[model samples]
Target: MGYDVDCDKMKDECGVFGIWALGQSEEAANFTYLGLHALQHRGQESAGIVSTDGETLYVHRAMGLVADIFDAGVLAKLKGGAAVGHVRYSTTGGSHVKNAQPLAVQYAGGPIAVAHNGNLVNAEALRSELEAAGSIFTASTDTEVVVHLLARAHPAAAPGTVEHLVGSVRQALGRVSGAYSMLFLTPKAIVGARDPMGFRPLVLGRLKGNWVLASETTALDLIEAEYVREVEPGELVVLDASGLRSERLFPDRPPAPRLGRCVFEHIYFARPDSVLFGRSVYEVRQAFGTQLAKEHPVEADVVIPVPDSGVPAAIGFAETAGIPFAMGLVRSHYIGRTFIEPQQSIRHFGVKLKLNAVRGLLKGKRVVVVDDSVVRGTTSRKIVKMIRAAGATEVHLRISSPPTAWPCYYGIDTPTRQELIASTHSTAEIATYVTADSLGYLSLDGLYAAIGAERTGFCDACFSGQYLLEFPRRQNHAPLRLVGG
Candidate 1:
């Protein structure tokens, strides 16, 4: 069989990169590529890079993974001192080549390449306003809206002035609302900013005398960069020859939200190796498993994880329950996220094509399978069926997260309420629906212990229906209130 992009689609968040050459143009692309690789978990739809020398800007964007999109030949063609890159998964816009990012725009002044990590709740409204004023769009992504806003926001100044560039970002921020951790690259320097709420992550690092900015600390770790610190919420930071400068964009925008951080960053989105908001992602997931063990103890001969995403939690479950942990399902690592089948109707059939049950390990065993979370129920049901077909005596399902009942508006590609399986089914109902012997989910409180209380905070609207921000009243659905589990 030929290679097919794995179509087992999950909620994907985009990754962003920023680089200040510090007179070293040769290594910027390599550093950004390694950084993006560490952040590959953040997105898989496409990868793009934009770089600027003191004189000119270079851009290269294509659909696929970072390795697929740029090689030495491609990177050589992109020459610049300052650079910014993006790996994108379009949650708000239709996925297309035009939607691939580090979107470069040519304004009346010099060009600016922009890469963004979060969602804008007011995108549609903002797009409408721009369209009303005759702004033409090349991509459907909300990121393009920022460029349009910047085109208007750009102050009239003499060419090559930093004032004009910084002013544009400040102006765009005034007009847009919602979550964002963005990087802007001009010909001379790289600028990074986070929304006042800091719903997404962005960090500053230094390596070989150059400064770097990325969506996750793991990215810095991969490139052997020394992490300086997280870019403070509502702070705008500029990196250039003079060095790093910071300013608060929203000094009066209320007290720092106690719960403004993105919750899914801990759950299914981030790489387990990542350290988010002070807690290790793997440690937090293991806590989820331990919590699951305490809340819903189960009887089984072996505790097996679905692999990769489920390993940490399964390890926690096995340790807590004093059961042997085995590898139950093994995944083929060759496939890309865009793995397509012949048609949409049979698209999900690709999951089986990517993963297989180890009969020798699972045969005749009462197996407890742990996974991160179940979105639509299709994958879980199929996995259970596979275990049964492999001669498993009983399949007990353990989920490391509470039921996901709401669609994520900040960035994750969760489905609407009608399409979410847990939103429509109870825990017992889900167990029956997936054909598992029994099932249990970790509680919200359990997550705190898993990730630790002092290190993490989340916006768990999907589990408990409490949006950290006021719910916007939609014309299609009534205004939502904070609902408890």
Candidate 2:
């Protein structure tokens, strides 16, 4: 069962999946269930699935993990030919069951189920316009904005029935702005689309005769699906019994289309086992560590990681620096990695339950402790203090990415700018606050080098102040209502 846990860290927003096939509605729901299970790591707060057998749509959603939401009894009830699933960590709307997605709606065109992976930048503007037009909203999610837009749209051209419906959706899609990797499921077909800047990851795959779409390739791997290719930026694909069809949403292709792919996907969000932006997340993380080691070589007797999240970079750092790598800090895998300690007195209690320093390994040693990123610095401080208590003669902290100095507005749940340690403090100050003898972070250029991709085509908003899209001049700094925080 999915349980709620609080910790000082970046939270992933959501995972989306949709499957459609010829004569496979009975099995489509099962495939989607497994796919959501594979992507459970992305979001653990709530999960839901919507399936359709061409004439009717079946929906089941709840505030819990996918494993807890469904079973043989539930799956048997969801007999359908096409299915779409979502696992969510609230970003825009609060963690209410009403906000849970594969958000099904009935309109003039009939049943539509939508699943989304990224936030909308201009959701407030769009929501206001919809409300003025007499639209009644049930949830305060940016996704429902699209539904309202669909209400006002007319089929631009209708040579066929399915094409007419797709045209109507295309018309509504043209009116929006911001990062979105969306799945639109109808009785007749399943559709997937990515934003023009492509700020989130979405991939296409196939299982037997079934066509599958998901936020990460790992979802496909779980069901033994063969990966097709990434859904390109500004591209919308429609899958039905006739098969897959695609159209570019923003067809004004530039000489070199710049896809503002989220760099954080490689830095932390994506599963190491998944391939994103055409690179293995594991390999990229290792590269980030290798690059960090190049930038910050330390004289230490041993190298250790902060635990599970820090292990990959730690491995890379150890290999690159030729330092001995050991589990100096061990994580309690049995404990919910997401443990909660709401009381101020128990703040340290939560981190302790998750990780503990190994006194035997750290005794009399100069340690190089590598971690992925330091967000609030509170947890990192507690960790460093624990390592000191474990008898480490010295602890030099190393990070695999540039310090996050800004907040992310796309699908990632992060502390506000004021809460970000790096946003208001210098590296020296951060080191002092964390109580580390010394500290080092990978350079921005080094991070780009690790990805082996040109930096110009990526979103580094959280690291650099430059935003890929234009922000409103009068910023409220309020959390987006359409997309989860």
Candidate 3:
């Protein structure tokens, strides 16, 4: 099987977009398509859309890019006044057409569709329990467990009733654990829910007096929607003909004392233009760079980012350090999933295919490289060598985020702790491994300062090894130690 050549970085699970135009003549599916297109960076393996025309749900799902999977014909066929869409990169399920989402089904509560953007830590256990109770799942994704849960919740309620649907969603979500930012589309309404801890991002917006839900504000910008506000952690907002209404998933329990918003969203997953947790993602990234510069001051002739993800931080570092900033490396945007492996003689052919050093700008310069994070250190090593080959006199490495030492159980695709270089190696050792003259990572305190939030409000589990929820323990895998307790 061909693997992603650039697989060393962390990957988000998926992106979700939903729109409710109830009595309007808007093309909900088309708006959803545009929103998904803007969120395409969050997930690229597959895309799907489901819409309801008040009585029936229409779905078009395929294993490909959103643009490739949807066209005028497909959108026209998805006739509806409300719709939900998903772009997926599997974290809890195998990558295949069967797992493409906006999972639509008919149940005791009538036809409903779901688009989910996070992982359920207890999915295996839930799947087992459901199976023992005679639930037959068509897909292996953790998201399917949710559909079944909703299908079984409030079995006594009359089907097709709003009360039944709302009760089913609340009851179903209350039982699941771990990160989730979900959207449910029914004949009557579109509902958006966030996990109580708020490990994932979901936001609300307004487009022509209608309600729109998206994983990021960038999607809202693409659709020209007015930015409303973030869907509060633990809150459920239902959008329908009567308008938006809020409910608490756990009506009795108080909200989590410290919301566990994923810190990595601002660092890498979200588009720089997005507003996450009421902060501009671009501004936060730049602050991370500035903080990194304050913590690790290195004398260098020029500072260059790793491109795209690294740009904002690099700019911040350069401005704060008073060093010349340049695009010393140029990245190719067209590299696809498939590529023929070159002979072993072709050193670093994979990395070269995606990035090339600008010899004219980098040669003879004391180059400081800024990157978002280092995973296994293999890619960083290659990048370092590439810069050296371009005649950089000295290569200093600076990372915007602290070392990621633990695997994420909440939707991000990360390597096991054993595979993470930082999990076992120290900063000096990692510098030597990556062949950098020196290395620095933004301190945890500096990170929180840049975010302008209390550490208690966000989840830095990947860096601190403090998981908010207990995850399933599998044989042969070491038990994840949760430091939150």
Candidate 4:
């Protein structure tokens, strides 16, 4: 029902965080801003910051990008030895300033601000229960559920106690289900926690004596912070007077089942320059294209990528296929905001303003078009039609990753079952629907090899329809496949 013009329909969410100790003299907000800018590709909706001077907690949050929301004056206002910041993309919240992150709540102890990076599967039911119990909600965001739970878990009388805060968070997390990587800001410390599955990323780093936790290591690199290590799945870290301390929150759950790092992190979600799970995102994506070519061979005069996200994989595909590659389509950097435009009519029209076919490159070319993944056929179909209109002799679509058949309950914004193009149709049907001359998708094995991660270790739930974490039962819209993208 939302803007359905784009053929491939996955919109990724990004979470970024930065923090400084009470004694540190550095401007924590500015460093956080730079880190968020580096991670901007993950989310573009809202930004917030909470800083503490050891005695008082200061906060500023709004619905806009980091660049648009925070300036020198705003950063100066958030004066503190320590701070936590968030850049958000709403997978389950309304796109308004009220729903913006660093959701803060005051108690007798002090103020606690939270920034969350993933979605909670049980949010709807939880919100209903809280609302019925007299919880007045300010924002219709799942994140506020945490605050409600925390308030109930920790009594107001408990003051200046990290143990009580941790206990409250643990109790709150015990009742919720699904992926989350969150940063908690108290006047005394900044804390980080990851869900048991580690469905989203949270990494730890250090700059001088200051500590930082972010959704990706790339953020640390941007601010010249030294990468300490990834905050382990189910691990809770507190940066306080005693420096960094970690505790196991969900000890009963066994170690990650092959460490289900989200495969899409490299395919489409993460920045190309970012490193994840000790591997280069750029290198992995290129490998994905190379593996895809080996698995799905096709004859073509030239190979072309779908631009931006698909460029790395497309290059790999071209090299592996021994075909020449060209920048066949150029993206318009001046495209208007898709979420802010008054209606879908404007957003759909905005797509054209963002992308244009290169007639000179497409003319008479037998092009093998490479893309990261296909969601709904809308965007892919439009792109194929555009290439044909641009005079390409034939357009063969090759996807580096496998088709997305299931909705992601973690963080990525994938449509429901009925809206997925691949869920209801076979590859051939999808090809015809998208108007591509021929179509090929990377096999699950090929995709595995592309990223070079252990097959037993990564989470391909979106592609395979298999879930590692226990989730609330939903109707099985499609049958599970042994092989996935």
Ranking of predictions according to TM-score:
3, 2, 1, 4
Model 4 error, position 258 (Å): 5.4
Reference-based lDDT, residue 327, model 3? 97
Name the regions of candidate 1 deviating beyond 4 angstroms. 1-9, 154-159, 338-349, 454-456, 475-478, 482-485
131-187: candidate 3 lDDT, tens digit per residue: 999999889999999999998787456778777778889889988998999999999
Candidate 2 deviant stretches above 4 angstroms: 1-6, 157-160, 252-257, 337-344, 473-485
Residue 131 lDDT in candidate 4: 93
Model 1 lDDT per residue over 179-237, tens place: 89999988867889898768899889998778899998889999888988888778999
Compare the candidates by TM-score and give the number of the best one.
Answer: 3
lDDT score, candidate 1, position 241: 76
Worst 10 residues of 2 by lDDT: 476-485
TM-score of each: 0.93, 0.94, 0.98, 0.92
| Residue 210 lDDT, candidate 3, scale 0-100 | 93
lDDT for model 4 comes to 0.81
lDDT of each: 0.82, 0.85, 0.91, 0.81
**Cα distance off (Å), candidate 1, residue 52:** 0.9
lDDT winner among the candidates?
A: 3
